[model samples]
Target: MQKISQKSIHKYLRHDKKFPHVWCPGCSNGIVLGAVIRAIAELDLKKDNIAMVSGIGCSSRMPVYADFNTLHSLHGRAIAYATGVKMYKPEMDVVVITGDGDATAIGGNHFIHAARRNIDLTVILINNYIYGMTGGQYSPTTPHGDKATTTPYGNIDPTFDICKLAIGAGATFVARTSAYHAVETQSFIKQAFKHKGFSLVEIISACPVIYGRLNKKGDAPTMMKQMKDDVIPIKQYEKLSPEQRVNKQTRGIFINDTEKMEYTLAYQELIDSLKVPKGDSNE
Candidate 1:
């Protein structure tokens, strides 16, 4: 029963005073960070036994700020690196943090395969629809026909629903939420950590500096307000008509199926079935 704060996490981290964080103002990355930290604190996970890995992006910088064993890895390979770490050290609570571009653009292959494997890991994907750190390029999550520096005329490219992708790729737990809903976002993250199989929480955050300026989504406050107006709670959504729900928002635990076997356990089962002789130390 520890509170998540600078003092509480200081003992577990390498550097404390050096962090108000380097992320831009009005960024949802901070909220996401707070949610994850809160979740870890709530779970009472040992900092020594937790590993956070990240790829290159604004969101990828998360591991650097977290008070845990961490790896700041190459672009688009956070999940792959995390999977390897978990496979070797199955006791670690491995969390992978990456942006939309880092996760789905260059990292698309790795992302899908990780989901397919159903590895015991929690993936926190912060999807803000543009490359925030690298001058606002259009990303895989960019809405169709939205403007970005790379898509000045209009995007015309389809945006990927990350939660749906994770679910379809075979992740055992999949959920989605916006940075606007801090409480719900934290709740989903906590649940994802508790789930034994591959779990994914696709956080739809607002990037006012990049996405808003380009897509005319307005300022940070405006973008947040849009989320508040658009995201329909699960309870209220259930009461809505089919017509009313069309093209409308719905946010909740979209999928939760724990029956799926995790990769580590499954691989162990395969080895057991093979009956490989235990006598080989180096033979």
Candidate 2:
């Protein structure tokens, strides 16, 4: 593999210094973004060959900040757009970045179908629990009994376990990591990128300004500290009792497996089997 430097990766950054970031200070989205950039740099993937697609929401803003060929698409349609991109230009490294609501709620259908088809795409779901960009509305990943602007009486719905959902949807690779664990998050992103078929990385991020304040999770620092303190390493988790594991454990790498015959590959095989000579007209 070709080696690339951080300086080279920095060149691909799209956000300007003068404008500053739109995200609130201490938000974990910045950390997730940094990890993603590091992963891409480590992989040595060419900037021009990579295409990043995003749906509407705070997380959707990520592609705008990334230096790759970016598309700020409609809400819950990022994966749909990315699927089209990959189907057309199979060589392109297509990535879909979306939020919990964008991926699991309004875009729920697209999410499952993409995984079911095993499209060659990497999906990074940045979940902050609430609709950060549109105030503190409850999202699909919002925990039960959590308070949000729209759920003033506490959220009654059960939250979606994104990793499990991805696995159930037939994703070749599925992993969950919190934003506080930058190293693990980057490593997981690298693994996801390397996985041949559909891959999904559900990153739990801190939204201090919106979700944090609304849910009384304290400031960004406190929320991140909670994550760091609560998240048990996968190795350490193996040693823990079942009850202990239930009490305080944020597991890692929940699922990782390869799938045979990804959608594009299967399509190509079908075409090859047709065996019609090029430029020949069949009667």
Candidate 3:
């Protein structure tokens, strides 16, 4: 075990002002952000060689805070932008910071296709189960029967299992953790970054102000407790009866290092094969 100082972490933050993050007190976005920063730091990745792309939402704001080659793209278009970045500079580390709504709603098409291609991109989807930045509307990942601004009568629609969505869509590496488990979240993130093909680490986070207040889930700490209590370790989850497993959150690595053809590499091969030699080409 090595020591990591607060000072070391601060160096990665945007230094040209922007003090006082706008996230509400007890919001888990900051916790998730710290896990991301720590994972990148522990991996010893060069700041310049890494690129963070994000779409519109609370979680998508991660790119603005971190010192990296960042692109704050339009709503639900982060992955599309990131795909281009990865294709153009395949050597650079490309990561997407997206919210549940941003990744699964307007962005769902891009997300699934990106996963299907098995591109070398790490996607960190922070799932607070509500649209935290946009008036706490119901989102794709919102639990069934949960109350939201848009769903005053309770969410009638079945919620999406983002982890399953990623795995089914062909993500080679998929995992889930929570802001309450910072070290575990960071661990999964590091693994996601190291994996060659598409990887997704879904962080179950807290939105105390909007989602929590609307649902009467108490303040930030209370919501965080709910996050911690909601999950069973994946190993233990397997032992539970099917009846017992309903609505239980399971943490830990679901898939690791599954082999797949990386899209960027295949694309490069295509480009190389089509390139004609300078002397062989007709004028």
Candidate 4:
């Protein structure tokens, strides 16, 4: 891929209309947005050919700032909306931007079923471990014993391994990365766009104002450093002993299956199969 510049990325953003994004001072959503823009620019994709759909959340606010064919739908319905866009115009690249609560909590069914159907949609799930925009509530991916507005003492719920869920749900392309690793995140996004079936890139992001403050995870910089230290590449993580792997997360592609037919393509094939021959007439 050709090298991208900060100035070039501006072309993809609605900076003139949506200046000064709404994310917190130390939030990681900006980093993820940068990665997304860079990925699209690197691919040289036409803005008209891409449909960016998002649900209600801080992350969902991204599409409003982007210059693509965009949709800001209801909470937990980004995937469903994106699916419709993909089905109607299978030639367009549909990207779904969603948050932990928006995607896995209220939208878990949509997320899983999209994977099961193997539709060609790139899902960028930003896992911040808490409901940042709504409140300081604990989310599905919140770590066990973590503090939150709802769990003042500590949360006892076990966290969801997003990558594992996507793989098990049959997403043809599954990968994990953090906001700190901007280059890797962009690379994974590019890969997801190229994949033929359901593609999920779960980006572990930071919500320093809410989740970090409640959990005593320090400021945004500290949280970013923690992300750098806590997550190891999948290849290196595989070499660690069981004990060493504890409390650690792995980054890298978990699966990329090319055999399964994409839902849109399969549906088109079915439509074609039902069509009568050009010269044949059935009385």
By TM-score, the best candidate is: 4
Q: Between 1 and 4, whose TM-score is larger?
A: 4
Write one digit per residue (lDDT tens) for candidate 2, span 172-217: 8888888988888888999988888999988888898998888788
**Cα lDDT computed for each candidate against the true fold:** 0.87, 0.85, 0.90, 0.92
TM-score of candidate 4 against the unseen true structure: 0.97
**lDDT digits (tens) for residues 194-267 of candidate 4:** 89999999999989999999988999999999999987899889899999988789999989999999999999
If the candidates were sorted by their TM-score against the true structure, best first, what order would they fall in? Answer: 4, 3, 2, 1
Model 2 lDDT, residue 71, Cα: 97
Count of clashing pairs, candidate 3: 0
Q: Where's the lowest-lDDT run of ten residues in candidate 3?
A: 1-10
The most accurate candidate by lDDT is 4
lDDT of model 3 at position 110: 95
lDDT at 146, model 4: 91
- Model 1 bad stretches (over 4 Å): 1-17, 234-248, 274-283
Looking at model 3, residue 87 earns an lDDT score of: 91
